[model samples]
Target: MSSTPALFRLAAACAAAALLAGCAVVSVASTAVGFAATAASLAVDATVGTAKAVGSVVMPSKAEDKQ
Candidate 1:
């Protein structure tokens, strides 16, 4: 499972590097909005992880549910 992501990352990096040889990439003024969206998404994920961790430690599922 974990190896797949590494393989994908390697392929994506190679492709990105291949496309960046002396090329002029166009820029837009929407970077701030993109950054804000990414930060908000990351914040939400962290919040959810924290809530799950606390919940599992505090009020775990009943033993019968594991059957």
Candidate 2:
């Protein structure tokens, strides 16, 4: 019957919409994770720089002894 084809079309459209929505959610999640990772990396780098600065102040390098 003609109604059966219309029902099939409606079902297909709903499925496609659901698939696109799921993809959008995944994209947002991936972006958030990437931002977090970048922020963490920057924090670690800053910590390391501070430690190195402290270390240098506490113990002068042997190269400085020649000067």
- Most accurate candidate by TM-score: 2
Clashing pairs in 1: none
Worst 10 contiguous positions by lDDT, candidate 1: 21-30
Candidate 1 wrongly placed segments (more than 4 Å): 1-28, 64-67
lDDT winner among the candidates?
A: 2
Q: How accurate is candidate 1 locally (lDDT)?
A: 0.82
- lDDT tens readout by residue for model 1, 2-67: 999999999999988877742434233366678889999999999999999998888877984687
Which lDDT tens digits does candidate 2 get at residues 13-55?
9999999999999999999999999999999999999999999
